[model samples]
Target: MSVNVITYDVGTTGIKTCIFEISDTIKLITAAVEGYQLYIEENGGAEQDLKEIWNAMCSTTIKVIDNSKISPGSIQGISFCSQMQGLVLVDKNGEPVRRLMSYMDQRARRELKEGMGNGLKISGVNFLKLLKSIKITGAVAASVKDPVWKYNWVKRNEPENFKRVHKWLDVKEYLIFKCTGNFIMTKDSAFGTMLFDIRKGKNCFSSKMCKLLGVNMEHLPQIAGCSDKVGLLTEKAAVQLHLKAGTPVFGGGGDASLIGVGAGAVSMGSTHIYSGTSGWVSTVVNKRVLDITSMIASIIGADDNSYNYFAELETAGKCLEWVKNHLALDEINIYLQKICVSDSLESLYVNLYDFMLEEIKNIPAGSHGVIFTPWLHGNRCPFEDSLARGMFFNISLETGKRDLIHAVMEGICYHLRWQLEAQRKKIKTSKAIRFVGGGALSPLTCQTMSDILGCEIETVDSPQNAGALGAAVIVAVGLGILERMEDADKLIKVKEVYVPNTANKEIHDRNFIVFKSLYKNNKRAFRIINK
Candidate 1:
């Protein structure tokens, strides 16, 4: 009489599976997972072995079933949430043709250039104003890096693989096929590929961009809604994962969109910030507000009926890890302990982490005379430039780690603010920011974000696992266990809130001006150095 739902989150680093019972009281029975490696090749390209990831998914699913001590027949449905935009090609027999190209892969740079023609151009807005408005991580607007481009790359570079390929899939759809023996793309996942028309809720590969690349829309899978049932688990999959063969499978979405749902960020003007390996600031809109310039407006949430505008930063936690591993490897515990012990160490320090922390701490509400452009992996959203790199300006030896630290955090915040401003301008009612993902765990970071942005930052319960929970909620809806998407808020709860400290607002405001100027002042220098 009870319904069990199993959800899998195919993430950048690994696969996580959670088994839960859907009833008046939602209960998590068990969680399990297996890890995978991320391959980064030359020229900023990143990839993952599709077969290996699938194996991990299967392994994790079985592990969760076993851990839950529940029989396969008890599960009514299974669903997934996956990293967005990765390209996977399959043979006629539904076997992978090659390794999946990850969202981070930059091999499509040339394709983007050729597709856009004459560098990057915004249709109706000032390029500079647009750049300052959207989240300008090096990745956004850089070029056509969707599966279409990657598929073409394979066709040109590896003709044999292309010849054997029958259908192309994003990460989520591929995983669905592997589990349910169905080949379908969810609208939420397809929207991010740049191959779908967010406005019309249909595949938009026919746009000038696809024509330029000689891509056929037929090569991609048919798009479906997130709640649409693609198929039931096959006998083999059911037996292997301890689930019923006829168990329904719903089309899951990108982790970003699901995170929004899981965090109760369903209404218009509500923003959600996810900071894991990378970071993103996303807000839902009732309809498409296509800014001829600025941030990306992708179809997320339930369908093309709604829109999710995002300004993403590619490396927030990753940058912190880089500093921890390379710069202060020996002082990690020491620095972490200092947060609770040493008062002087709290005041100022330099190096990437220390400087970033301090500038975020002091620098008179903003980095008074400093700004940092985070281009560790290039920019996304507003200014799509792959060749772009990071920079810090107006630095003096007098500037200690505190100032630098504050500058780094403030710099990232400034970019987030840029995204918020752009979305607000287009949507007119955008407000409320919710922080999710791993970075949201830090009270200090959340407080800093609230102060710099002058908005309240709320951390949802289970911040780290919101995406996985979101996937489960989708499954619950698909299986007829939950009545509506909005009902999820009652099932989910927020754990904490970080309000702005007006005392630091003045300093943050001052530093924001410097942060805004870094890109302009250092553009030529960055290009030269990269050259």
Candidate 2:
């Protein structure tokens, strides 16, 4: 009577593998995390080692099964939720041709500009092309961070690689192919490419948009339904993962979509905020919506025949990682080395984030007038400015490390607040928004988000595991273990609720005006200085 599913959540910074019991109320049996390095270079180049990612996935899956003492045979299926917009090119042999270009990469700014020049004029995209794109896709951003730009960049810069590429797969699809020997991606993953007819909600590429973008559609993979079983796990992959062979592999979804499902946002009009490496404010909606000005747009959702209205911030937990690496690592290394830890750097890096959260709890809202910008790698939503840079404005002599730290957290919350405001312009949001992500694990961030946004913030147990759970839920639905994805509402148990602090509302409101103006005031300057 015991049935389980292993879901792998492949995020930008790492992979988290979780095992879930398939039932009326899904239970998370156990989980394990495996980390990887992101190679970031000047002029907006960010990449990941694809081989290491596969290794991380396999190792983490083994760790979860071994740690939980669960029988691999009991696992009815396997699925995935992965970071969207990353481009992974593979050869005819299904081997990675090169490292993946991350969603964080902004190298195609020039190309995006060239596309939207006198021949066209829609800021990031061509005006005429934009019209058709908006009509069919429901959303279109001609940014270098999008997979289309990455594909174009590869074709232009590495012509040899482009010719050799047998398929252009998103991160999740690459992993799926590794397990099932099928080159496939879900509608949600394809939506991230900005080359799909989102309005039609088709599980295939858009030839019209591809023609406009000058992208060869031949390189793309076949699109599949979010919960459709793609194929059975291969014997080779089963041996590597220490799992049973012939396990069903379902077509999972993009990280944001799955996270929405995992956060119990399966019903229309339900909303949730996820802060992982990147962050977003997403709401499930029945109708397609697009707001290019506010950068709030519709993308394919994990649930069948649904869409998600969202605005994304490119950096969230990533900013915190920046702080840890640049600001706190030295002190942490010394402390850990004193404790005789062999790998002090890694040890401090892994365990110090929770410590940082504990320290942030004592700081008040607004960080005592020290406002930080969470745009270290530029922003994607509430505006489409890639040249924007992160800053800790209004720092005074009285400011301390705690203030700087809290400001970073508050800065991310402020951006989310901006996104929430933009999303409210289109539709009604839920009374209480659920929060899920690795970043959502921090009580301080949740409280800060609630205080700044003036809304109730709900947290579920294992917030970091939301994407993984969502992927498993999709598998359960595909296998008829669950009737509907909406049942996630009953499956997800709310572990905590963060109420807004009324006393701090005035400062947040006052600072929000300043926060809103800071970008506009510096827009020209950022373009000049950064470019």
Candidate 3:
């Protein structure tokens, strides 16, 4: 018998609702997307309205269900794969205490300093605290953007709201509560807080780390496995989503945990590159590891007794989105009008990006010495610098607009290669890495990534829905359609593969060296300019 499930892949800027029919293999039935704003404050604050996000999820869910012509009763379960590290505080009524504090928010500088500051340090974090956290969680929140620091910021700055906090949760946890009316945080989301005792089997929140970090243990919610059935759909959520009242709701995971599964990188030592709004290089590992120098760590995964050594870039496809608006607005507008004047063409922004990429395929690798940095919203992993801003370097009078465009893409790929190399330092990554995300929809991007990273790039069908597909897999496991999460690779099939082009190796190699130096050489200057 075929089983159908719904998954919401909640991203930084939007939510993607996908329906999948899982039987012998996973099949995408219908998908719908709705975008919400990431409200940016002047004081290094970033937030999203929980109501808006919830509404978007509801709207997309209804759309996908109606569009697919599938009986809503047939949907076995609903799950989510959300952006990690967000701070959402809920009260007794299960409503958000405040606007959701985004993972992009970096206003916790004061809390970060007071907690992990100057006296004795390791990798810029307090030495003793780092050791304790590494021992307990196998990770440390050296980056100010972590949920712990955000939790600290609210406690000190918004004391009244802090008093009202009933439970602390991440992005997925908030939605999971809204759907099932149960307070739960998936294990992967718990691990992302840098407070969960990875060494402990269950009830793993570490008192030592939480006490040292000043987070109240009472506010932590009960932990659930990624595929564990949290509860049935609440009557209110069912009405809003046009689904059955008692549909099972599963404990979905964070993007970092499940996107790899969607890309079919589920087995141990399987590596994948995800280039979405934000991007990362993640390798599934059997044992936990930590790299403080590179800000990379093997975090708990959705699968039992597994981990992914994850390295991230804050802005990957976001950089491409940036260039589309600022650098190639004219070309984009013209292309949109040529295809369809309405939002239909524009809604599929990846198509516009592919149109642009098609225009620059012949622009040569490395953009003829012009280089761009993918740090428009700052950077993470390898170097944690919010002051870092993007730039187009080595631009000469001879440089054309196309060259600049190509440079922006090469710059993004170079950053990915840099991260992949960092993971290689601790573990062996697959030579032919699976590249999945909206960015992977472009053949030129696949080829460019393969060329710049000097490896084969593999892509799967519906690459853009990899996160949601991964979530569907979790739901399938929960519903007994699949035996385990590890069976994900058996369902997903590779659609295409690209091999590296040896001819462009020299230029990319030379530019990548300069690209690596851009930060080290200019980090001090970046702080000065951005400050």
Best by TM-score: 3
TM-score of each: 0.84, 0.95, 0.96
* Better by lDDT, candidate 3 or 2: 3
lDDT of 2 by residue, 1-531 (tens): 547899999899899999988766788998888899999888789999999999999899989989999889988999999888898999988998889999888898766766554474755556887788888777775566877888888888998888899998999899989998999878888888888776444546889888878888898788888999999999999999999999999999888889988987788888999998899999988888888778788787877667889889999989999887777567546554454334756565457787777767888878899998898888888888788999989989999888998888889999999999999999888889999988888887888889999999999988888899899889888988778888878888789999999999999999999998999999999999888
Q: Write the per-residue lDDT of candidate 3 for residues 234-333, one digit (tens) a residue.
A: 8998999999999999998999999999999999899999999999999999998888998899988889768999999998999989888888776546
TM-score, structure 2 vs. true? 0.95
Using lDDT, rank the candidates from best to worst.
3, 2, 1
Candidates in order: C-alpha RMSD to true structure: 6.0, 2.8, 2.6
True-vs-predicted CA distance for residue 217, candidate 3, Å: 0.9
Best by lDDT: 3
- Total backbone collisions, model 2: 0
For candidate 1, write residues 455-489 as lDDT tens digits.
Answer: 88888766767787888778777777777776777
Model 2, C-alpha of 401: deviation from truth (Å): 0.7
Clashing pairs in 2: none
